[model samples]
Target: MTDKSTSAPSSDSVSHRVADTSPESDRGEQPETIHEDRLWCDGGWTARVIKNEDDDGWAVEMIKDGEPEPALVGPWTMGRNKKDPKPLDVSAFNTLVKTASEVLRRHEQQLRAQLHKRVAVDAATGDGQWEITLDIVPDDDEPYALLTAIDAFGEQLAQVQVAASFKLSKASAASWVENGFRRPG
Candidate 1:
């Protein structure tokens, strides 16, 4: 969800921040280009339009700035934010806003997940540290398997994806890995 409200977040005053950081901001490198007039969550993110040198459409880039790479590229536009603005409406601004917002949101989500320790499984190999219990029932031609990796206390460590046509074993899998798995001939 993108909020295009006129109210800017206190932390995200684009004018002030842009002035503080970009050296070219003062020289008017970062001008207030108009478009759908789209602003999200008080400029937390905004899309900016750029002119496409090759085509008739416009190039829209989402400027995150908060992330390592501030400029995130998006699809080009046809008209200026869909409608006519009072002046030379650069629709890229709105596009930038939306794109930047999405990037930020995903970044924040990843951060939160990393910080919280919900599930932890040791992905180490072959000390007999974990046990894999696979029950293959081949009756009535209904072949199936319940693949589970469990700890010492019967607690599930991880669920492994098993194929319905189970034909591979650990030794074979290891050999395949070591051999770089070429065509069978």
Candidate 2:
């Protein structure tokens, strides 16, 4: 005698997703597809040729994965007809990707340097060196900067709040350290 009411569902009875056969299913990114006006899913990047909003000229936008906005947007070359954009090719695609990547890299570096500026200055007490840093906090309501000094021993010498847009120059940092990390009047 069998008691069907007490039996639990077997693994085979539970619904399961079938194995994906697409080549990109394993990489977890969309596969590359090319079109006359758009190129996407190629190496985690996408480039599209669009009509310029400001004029009749064409423009190209290169976007990286998971980003809402394009990383690079600039004028695209026109074709012989002079009204349509030149078709995107492999060599052109590679070049565009490289240039866009460089632009992103440089922009990130510049931003990082701006947000966290640092300078080494002579310690106020002696010949020993101290590192001064100005970290900007761009708060929505009230933005500010934290001027900090660290000794060679990695000890916090002093910290003060200054304007968010404060520029940390070598001379200014030296002067600040000499003045006991106080906000210059």
Candidate 3:
């Protein structure tokens, strides 16, 4: 029999072999599973244990598939010997994926909040309250916003394009309604 240590295939080779036989390969998709001492790739995320720049300790970075940057990075535990990092495991990798997914979710929520605004004001016509919303489009060439007015029944009354810098507030919405939905100056 051959010596296992000397004849063992590298993780990269093993990964390719696994992918070649996987169903995804039939459709030209890359294999998404990898388990290594310092690296774990699965479930649309990859967790890598790396050396910390500020200290002698270790850090783990979680990167979503197709993303250029890691979504989360934090300290990692040391192994029993204290000189080497703790080997990555299934549980630890799953936890890292959860935390990284949460980070991405919060980031998306914050971005949506920044780009959308809403205010409710009494209609100048004395008909009823109207919900005014501003949705900003952050285009590189022509950044703008769409100001919309909706009645209490959820029917849209008006929509106008405005500068992206337009501020949405109760007073401003009231002014717009009072001006008969004319484009805000």
Scored by lDDT, the top model is 3
Prediction 1 TM-score vs. true: 0.29
Q: Is candidate 2 or candidate 3 better by TM-score?
A: 3
TM-score of 3: 0.86
* Regions more than 4 Å wrong, model 3: 1-23, 27-30, 125-127
What tens digits encode model 2's per-residue C-alpha lDDT throughout 46-141?
888777999988788999888899999999998655766666666777888999999999998998887898999988778588999999987899
TM-score of each: 0.29, 0.67, 0.86
Per-residue alpha-carbon lDDT of candidate 1 for residues 1-185, written as tens digits (9 for 90 to 100): 21236233333223321223456556854544323323322244445445456765545556554545554664453433453221213344544465666777888787654332222233344444445444444446765544555665677754444444544455433333334333211
The lDDT, on a scale of 0 to 1, for candidate 3 is 0.84
Q: How do the candidates rank by TM-score, highest first?
A: 3, 2, 1
lDDT of 3 by residue, 57-126 (tens): 9899999988999999999998665867777777888889989999999999999999999999996668
Clashes of 1: 14
The root-mean-square deviation over C-alpha atoms between each candidate and the true structure, in angstroms, is 15.0, 14.9, 5.0
lDDT of each: 0.44, 0.76, 0.84
What is the Cα-based lDDT of residue 39 in candidate 2?
42
